[model samples]
Target: MTLGFTALVTAIVGEVAGTMSLRKATTGSKAWFVAVAGSYVFAFSMLSVSLAQGLPLGLAYGIWAAAGVALTAILSKVLFEEPLTPVMGAGIALIVGGVLLIQVGSAY
Candidate 1:
């Protein structure tokens, strides 16, 4: 993959990690608090780098937000045994489709 794409992926992963840590941090864990803060800082830094590398901000942010939401939901189900009802599944599908649309629209 291209460097910019790799950076965007890194940013998304960091965002997901930060969001996941938010749950544990809220329970008063100092270590988790550090993780949460660090993850977010890393994520934003990478996002900025991706933008600097010529990834369009609108497309990058749309993909980042959608992928983060979808992946976080799936990870929550796997890691925390959270529910993955049909409705939620449909919503995730919609998010993925929307991201795809954004990418396609940007290409033209």
Candidate 2:
């Protein structure tokens, strides 16, 4: 895969990990803070790589935001037993649709 693609994937992973760690940290655990910091470090490095790889800033940012929001919502529901109402689900679907449109535009 291209560097930009790799960076994007890495960024997503880091973001997910970071968010999870933060939730864990809320339980008064110092170790989880380490996880939080590490995840952010990895995320920032990957974002820098994505930008340096010449991916359009708007495209890269849009994908990052969309992926982060969707992943966080899904994971929160799964990991924390957070209830997902119909309205929230529909909003997520719309965000996913918008992400698809952005990607299609980038491909051309």
For model 2, the stretches where C-alpha displacement exceeds 4 angstroms are 103-108
Model 2, 16-87: lDDT tens digits are: 899988998997687899999999899988988999999887788878888888888889999998878889
Assess every candidate by TM-score: 0.93, 0.87
* lDDT value for model 1: 0.92
lDDT of 2 at 35: 95
Give one digit per residue, the lDDT tens place, for model 1 in 1-107. 88898999999999999999997787667689899999999999999989999999989999899999998999999877889899999999998899889889988
Provide the overall lDDT of each model, using Cα atoms, as 2-decimal numbers.
0.92, 0.87
Listed per candidate, the RMSD to the true structure in angstroms reads 1.1, 1.8
